[model samples]
Target: MEDFRKKLYEDIIIKQISRNNDVETAHKCIETLSRVVNNIIDSPNDERKRRLKEKSKTFQSNICGAQGGVEFLVKIGFRAKVIDFEKFYVLEHPLTDNPDSPEMEKLKVAQEILQDFLKKVKDRAELASKMQAKEKAAEELRRKAVLEKIDEDKERRVAARERLQARRKSQEEQETTINEESNSADDSADTADTTDTQSQPEQFYRAYHSSHYRQPNQKQD
Candidate 1:
């Protein structure tokens, strides 16, 4: 009978794990079950520990709604009853602290399994959190690299534009210098022409005076 009950409870735990598919919910259910078993083992004569209200929030959320919760309780000795149309599961024969008894052994085994399950669940949660954090950090690095590339491109464009503007300014300055030199040459040529014109007028005046001069010994034609 003890072997059969153990097998049955194991099947129920498998069902619970498969049905919930959530670590938190499974953890709560297992924790509650362990607590219930502990209460029964500690205080065998406590009526309240042996009585569980089906409609209560704790029972509904942690036990009744869970797949294997009520079945586990029933296997341990709880029987469903109704009083004033309110449902309850009552343990007529509470668990005793008999280390050799099958019920006590079953409860111990169940506690051991619950503890192991909780440890595994906690480890898995921590691993998942670490993986998520790593992914976020990698994404941040990628974003930073992209921003840096964009800034570098912007700087290169600005530098190229400045270089182009400088080259254009240099060309303009050279053209201005050449134009000034040309204008100076033109001014010098105009001044030379004016000096030559003035000398020619002076020479013509002297020649006319000499050709028509009196009191000078000259042969007449």
Candidate 2:
């Protein structure tokens, strides 16, 4: 199929170009027309994009059929008079329904075959872009949620530490009061033990002296 299109492109299209329409212009025109046709093929019948291939196909069929005076030139092989162009150029655009031209059939078949693939590519590109945008939004939401959770956890930890410090300080003050009371009790016990020991010795000495007959010594004096 491709080989057939190449043959038509080279033999018919290339041959049609002349001093009036240089080969460069012929290339430019063919390329431009191809881009336009491809654009029509890429567009869909959907509301987002318009379809124009069917109309373009009809026009292209006429253009290739007329062949810029190449068809009849092939017919007579250099015997085509300039008068043939003047009259027959009209016939080529509105082809006389000639079935023998394989070039015509090849062109029509290529257009029909490309139609489906072009539409598929166009729709796929649009769908892919939509999917990407949706994914981006989801990712942003997830990131925000993660950051919020982290901040909440940090605040909770800070609050817990502060509560723990307050509890520890209160317990330390209670322990200090208990230790001071214990020291005061120990000091009082030591003072009571010292007074009891000194009073016991003095009471023993007075008892001994009273037992030694102090009344007799006072009568002698």
Candidate 3:
């Protein structure tokens, strides 16, 4: 509830001064430790968690509030020093010590445990960033390739459609031409038949008049 940011991340251990002396500083120190622990707990980086399990990477672990650690610790005026992470055990440090002892050895141990977790997470950050960059590059290349293929397919479909339409039009024209030719032939045949029928009737009538009219001369004789 109080302003804990003043201490950054440290538990109030045995100072050279009395415990009651600089009492506000002690409360703020507790607040900072609480905040820092929460931040480490909810890390956004997944690779950090993986590395922590495998113990695959090297890190300069430390006791926070000591010296020679990350800038975040140094900025807060603590004597933090980075040490070998293998020697530190988070389970044994912060939670297991006697709370009311005059020598706050437990507080110092908590600081060390907290620092190790930070180092582990920070070590994996650079690698995760590089991997994300590589994945982004690959995705961009794949997107461009797919778009190009789609364009090529669209062009091919358009060309095929045009060819089919032209072929159908050609067939229709050929059919129209053949039908017109057939109609013309039928018309010519009908005309010839009509002309022959008219001529035969005319010739028969002329022959009948000529042969019958010859009997008129016998009456005069």
Candidate 4:
């Protein structure tokens, strides 16, 4: 792979010489760009390097090499101006020194910009995790609610079945009582009819015997 840092620095130097016609400013730019490249290249064990490697695999984004490092800062809202030349893009950082050397100030701004970009990435990840947690909570609530509704419906069905069984049992008891009463009444009527039939025959025999004896006696007299 080509050294993108060298390419970018060369482009910046060329543009600075031609457009601004200032070797000192161009040298400053070169130094600053060199420092950025070194910070990234030298720190193989840095957390930023590890994160960028992971990001490159998962997404088409990275902050590792010069090609994506400057672009990444710009994308994350760093106000470093980019002058588009015919063949290359040169980054322009404002030279602001407040009690600090210009080189120190430029380095500080670049560091702050990179740190802020990292913070923004962390914030985005945090927000996404929070949203996922909320969605999971909502799903759990919906699942619980559905289970509760199912339980309630099951209880209602059981209660209704019990009530129906009780009603059926009540109806059966009433029918049994009515049948017993009707059977008792029929038994009483049968006993009264049998007594009347037996008594009439006995009364007829006694009256016939007494009349025969009385006729014999009157004839004798």
Candidate 5:
């Protein structure tokens, strides 16, 4: 019968406790059991450590009300008892009496299991947190890089526009200077043509007079 009870309680710890509660609550339940086991192991002769009040708020919230909580205590040799009209679960055989017994061995194994589970859960949470932080930092770097690229593109466009505008202004100034020089050359050519036309009229008059007034000595031809 004791062996059967131990088997039943072990199954409860392995399956029911985690199934019935959220992870935080489940861990709390396991931690409570660990403390209880540690207390019993440390003070096997302490009557207080051997007994748990059924109606106590802490016991009800952390242990009795939790699935498989009562069963786990039972597996370690605790039994339901009534004392002075109040109810309690009391250890019948203090595990310290026979540390090498199967019950004591089972208790130690259960403690080991609980500790291992808690450590694994803690490690997983830390790993997840670190991954999230790394991802966030990477995202921030990507965002900054994108913004910098945009700014660089904008600056290049502005510089290109300014250069284009400067080139256009220089071309316009050169055209203006060439047009002014061409106009000055055209004016000088026109003035020289007018002066030549005036001189030609005076020369033509002198030639006509000289031809008419030929040498008087010359005989009529």
Candidate 6:
């Protein structure tokens, strides 16, 4: 497929130079034609390729097809002219004894310029693909880091909740212990007060009876 495309590009260059002998014009024509060629090369559209090749052979006047023989020469800025297609001047350009021909010289110059252009385009595309891959890798790393951070935060929160629960449980137990001790102390104080109250009444009653009996005995004496 790659070889086919290279041959196709070379054929288009030859055709463009043969028709107009202008490299700049030929380059522009190829620039427009590259889109269709690249698509066919990438996707392998047989029908499209066949149609494009057919279009290349047919000419409006003297101009060749700009893109895969489908696009018109006038569309690519070429003027129409009525010429005998059978008796056309076959100036063998870039690869013939007539290398010194003005048209052939133009073809050579155009070929060099287009080769450089295509190379730069290929290099830029490769660079773009690499950059996109790097971006995707960085994004994946960022996503993983976010997930890890979320897990760490969840674990920390769970630990914090457990610690809080434990502290609350301990505080509740301490409070319960204090309340029980207060109640026991209150009960002991109440029991002591009741015992003192009962003893005091008994002692008072005995003293009163003894005093009354002793006074009567003194009067009899």
What candidate 2 gets wrong by more than 4 Å, as runs, is: 1-101, 112-116, 185-221
Best by TM-score: 1
Residues 1-221, candidate 6: write the lDDT tens digits.
34433543455444444254333334444454444334333333243331232223333212343333332322222233224443221212123336574433443444444566555545655776788899999999999999999999999999999999999999999999999999999999999999888888443444446665575547753
* C-alpha TM-score for every candidate: 0.58, 0.42, 0.40, 0.45, 0.50, 0.48
Provide the lDDT at 188 for model 5. 94
Could you give candidate 4's per-residue lDDT for residues 111-154 as a string of tens digits? Answer: 55434434444565577679889999999999999999999999
* Each candidate: RMSD: 6.6, 14.9, 15.9, 14.5, 8.5, 12.0
TM-score-better candidate, 2 vs 4:
4
Candidate 3 per-residue lDDT over residues 1-221, each given as its tens digit: 12233233333233211133233333333334434444333431322321221132222322222232223333332232223543321221122234454223333444454455345434545566677799999999999999999999999999999999999999999999999999999999999999888888443434446556667556653
Greater-TM-score candidate between 1 and 4: 1
lDDT assessment of candidate 6: 0.50
Please state the error at residue 158 of candidate 5 in Å: 31
* lDDT tens readout by residue for model 2, 125-149: 5676788799999999999999999
What range of 10 consecutive residues in model 4 has the weakest lDDT sum?
Answer: 57-66
The positional error of residue 34 in candidate 1, measured at the CA in angstroms, is: 1.5
Q: What is the lDDT of residue 120 in candidate 1?
A: 74
lDDT of each: 0.78, 0.47, 0.44, 0.47, 0.78, 0.50
* TM-score comparison, 3 vs 4, better candidate: 4
Better of 1 and 3 by lDDT: 1
